[model samples]
Target: MIQVAFYDIAEESLFDFAVIIAIKEGKWILCRHKDRRTWEFPGGHRDPGEWIEDTARRELYEETGAEHYTLQPVCAYSYLRQGEKASFGMLYYAQVDELGPLPAFEIEEVKLYDKFPEKKDFWTYPDIQPFLLRKVSGLGIK
Candidate 1:
């Protein structure tokens, strides 16, 4: 099982890696990797010299083509990779307005859903969404 850590954006005590659980209006944003067929949240590694919050903003825009949005750090999370290795990322929630053309990159497509999709197993990191939802619910998404 993936373990979760929740924190306020102000606390700012997570690793450089980040993932954003973006919500536009009332829907959630998900992306399909160009190389990998599976879908996942809009986020990526915090590049050298980039802040975690900036990483979240950049990744969200790059992946989803979200033009105008409000992004906020909801939590910092860690999970067991390959059932043993520990991996961590910052979790963010976004309220997006306008979406523009997608930038040519690792992302192939972007999608929105009112709730978790039916074929949830197709999600890139199976534990990510549920864990994020549970943690955000536990902490409350602001």
Candidate 2:
């Protein structure tokens, strides 16, 4: 089984990745990776010595061409699968105001959604992404 848990922002240093659940013009933004047909939030691993917030911004621009946005740290989350060590990431919520051309990256394309799509098989990280989305939604993110 895959287990997920939330952490206080005070645990920031434990985070290894940064994921952005972003919105543009009232719609959610989702990205498709070049190697997979599944959709996912714009996010990525932190670079050596880089700030977690910078990881969020860099990944957002590289994946979705999100040029202008207001980003806020939503929470920290960790996920663990049976027989595997837990992985940690910080979650961010962004209200995007502008976009530029997508940089050549692992992400193949980005789509805007009126709501997170209901198709279960469409997600790249079904075990974790949807749960995170739901948590953020309950906090009144739109």
> Highest TM-score: which candidate?
2
lDDT for every model? Answer: 0.77, 0.91
Query: What is candidate 2's CA lDDT for residue 126?
Result: 95
Q: Write the per-residue lDDT of candidate 1 for residues 51-142, one digit (tens) a residue.
A: 88888888888999999988777767776655676666788788889889999988999988777756866788876667777676565543
lDDT of 1: 0.77
lDDT of 2 by residue, 26-135 (tens): 89999999999999999999999888999999999999999889999988999999999899999999999998998898888899999765788989999999889988
- Which regions of candidate 1 are displaced past 4 Å? 7-14, 82-85, 138-142
List TM-scores for all candidates, in order.
0.83, 0.95
* Runs with alpha carbons beyond 4 Å of true place in candidate 2: none
In terms of lDDT, the poorest run of 10 residues in model 1 is 5-14
Best by lDDT: 2
User: Over all chains combined, what TM-score does candidate 1 have?
Assistant: 0.83
